[model samples]
Target: MSSADDPKTARQPQPPSHAMVGTWRLVSYDVEVASTGERFPAMGERPTGYTIFSGEGRVWFMLTGDGRQPGDSDRDRAQLLETLIAYSGRYRIEGDVWVTAVDVAWNPAWVGTEQRRQFALDGDRLQVRTPWRVMPNWADKGETRSIITFERAVEG
Candidate 1:
């Protein structure tokens, strides 16, 4: 008898296991922030940041500018250009959906608030899109709602 005849062998091959791990550049993404139900810019617009991802189910996000332009004082700017927003979690495929489980957050305060980023990739460009509306309580006094695109950055 062949393995194909076994019941377990009938299961479809799981999506490549190493899919979610890697230094994926933010190619493009559309995000929406919450507010007083008024129109506003999408998330990742206020400040540009890079998401450092790993295969070990880890994520670290760091920002530099506010999309305006770099200021003088290279030293001061560099000083404020980084943050260790480290987190750990697991992700896998559930039928046709890519389920993401966020278990940890850099900011302990956000430990309980979980977020899911539904995204897809093409070549070197990655596009992350969300249907849910979000609001930044810190920025704009939490008055913003929008969907934006994030483009993948070319690695040097």
Candidate 2:
């Protein structure tokens, strides 16, 4: 068959609303400072995370840094909390952007807030990015843009 007629090659890009409905595994997460062009890992060089988009308009996401060990001390608990992010809520796709209305979040401050991310899809990979915003816990650090990439999870 001609390449243009092949199923894989012929598949057109789906709308974000349909294209995003699946489980995705985190590949990388980074942040770039607007002022200096300096880029750093939002979590770590090897962060771990999952993002799930349902056809029913529900979304769930979680992410954490690597090398975490259980600790009973308050310091450890604080460290743990600092290294993790999680939230769940309804989502909608508008143009090329995905907006999430947070119903619940690990950080209480995020609850009831609408988070927006620009998205791009290429085959099995998806990249979502945040517009420049002051890092929540580090407002003095200046504005930052978060970039996160994910690969569609394979069903077992």
For residues 55-100, what per-residue lDDT tens digits would candidate 2 score against the true structure?
Answer: 7788899999877889799988888998898999888898889899
The candidate maximizing lDDT is 2
Clashing pairs in 2: none
Query: How far off is residue 65 in model 2, in Å?
Result: 0.7
Q: What is the C-alpha lDDT of each candidate?
A: 0.47, 0.89
Highest-TM-score candidate: 2
